[model samples]
Target: MTTTISPSRKTNEAVRPAKQPLRDRLVRLQRRIPIVQLALLVLVCAYGLATLPGFGSWMSIKSILILGALVGMAALGQSIVVLIGGIDLGVAGYIVAGALMVTQFATLNNVPFGVAFLLATAGAAVLGGTVGYLCHRFRIHSIIVTFAMGSVALGLAQLQVAGAYGGGAPVWLTQMTSPVMGTLGLPIPPLVLVWAVVIVLAALFLHRTAAGRRLLATGANPRAAELVHIRTRRVWVLAFAFSAVASVVAGVFLAGFAGNVDVTMGNPYLFESLAAVIIGGTVFGGPGDYSRTVVGVLLLTVLTTVLVGQGLTGADKQILYGLIILAAMAVYGRERRLRDQV
Candidate 1:
């Protein structure tokens, strides 16, 4: 006897078996951890310990958290933009402008801190959105536009200060930088709480939302994303806007940490932020990776504090950063080429 299987039944069988659970895929992704980033973090921490006593002190620990929170926030912001095949040099502008504006409003104009915060974030969003729009609408390179915009922002920050700049932090702002509580006999800085919230929200936004997946898709292949009806332009705009928001928030934290703001104050963040993103295992053309960026931020902050404790000058920091940037790019570029070849 010959048995006949219907085509529909065969198709159904294939379809049912081909379906894989989302949880399993997520488990696999988690297993494929970025080991190198974590390893580098360990190495950096050890070096910091070897270099300075401040690496272990409560005061140094507090400073690292504040600085890490600020730089990590900025790096993560840049990571968002970077993932979408666009670079945001304007993040520097946002840091300078946002800090200056927030402080200017709170100090010079007597605007409430809450109101100033909103205004500063709004301004950053506008600036970032403008870059996003220009990139999508005019097909301009974000690198060029963002770079120019950043310069413009720096100039505006300088003008806003008008020689009235002094590094005096508000009482409330200072309080925010202090420890909220202690754990295991170690004080935990309040900024850690804020950073944790930002990171958690960021992770959820990028991993658990449709918009987040679309962002990844768009960055992976804009043409393919468009073909799939992904609304790539909207993705670009939103990514940039989000990045701007991160930059501004970072600026606020940094301004609080520094107890003041200046146009040149944000200068170091530009290079360091990009470097942190790179070292965090988020390569060029990669999507936002919140956890790794946080690690990178800590590494950099620790390194910075260590150097400061050793009385290292600005030139020494620059040299160290320059070397790290060069080495990171060399490694990433080579690996990318190898991956492409593979």
Candidate 2:
């Protein structure tokens, strides 16, 4: 007689392994990565509020919101371009250009607030579109092209100023953004409202529109996207245009806040926007969420505020920012590899 396996052994052999749900698998994978950055950011914000005198005060909060809002808008735009497998190093340049447009209009032409804002925004968009065209038509890398464009934009702004403040902005533009909306002892800055609108609109555009999906697909695989009849070049152009719009909006807001335009107003934001995008989990030329970008911007704003309060110089802040971005990239790289393997 042949040897027979035990009933328990047969049962064990017959039992198939349970498969994890997709959602569960995603959650587990997310946990494997260093996702604690978000929590850490929250903790840091709380610490800043508790330790820094007046840090939690209304004025401090308003200041953070206003600054964060402007930076967040630009970061959102940058994140979109990055998601589409491109980079726009021209954020600061576009911002400066936008601000200068408004200042020049108001100072020289005596343009109305509405007209100046529209002209500035439209001008920035055109600049962005031109950069996109240069990249697509010449088969140049977006990064190199945008970097050069940024230099040009910066130069133009400086040329306008010619070693002095660009005169001054219109009175109405200053008044519109300065007066805070007070509700029950809380001040809501106009920049905060602008930021909220941009975030919501961007989130919707990325998640709810077919064009957005096409952009993502183009970024994920341009060759495949083109094969599928998606106008990859147009998507690229649109991405740059969107980024320019963000920069211009931010510049306009800044103009209102500062009450005038200076060539250097946008210099600091170039790196800040990049940091915010990276820290928000938007990998370079990879999938990312705008909501996360917003959170990242807020986190950065808080960190910078605390650092300044602690007497850190601008150079020190820049160094720390660079380190943080590097750390985020490292983490993202590992996670990306893991995802590819899976």
Residue 256 in model 1: shift from native, Å?
Answer: 1.4
Count of backbone clashes, every candidate in sequence? 0, 0
Q: Let me know the TM-score candidate 2 reaches against the reference structure.
A: 0.86
TM-score of each: 0.82, 0.86
TM-score between candidate 1 and the true structure:
0.82
Off by over 4 Å in 2: 1-35, 154-164, 183-186, 337-342
Ten contiguous residues minimizing lDDT sum, candidate 2: 333-342
Model 1 residue 285 CA deviation (Å) reads: 2.0
C-alpha lDDT (0 to 100) for residue 69 of candidate 1: 81
Give the poorly placed runs of model 1, Cα more than 4 Å off.
1-31, 155-163, 166-168, 179-186, 336-342
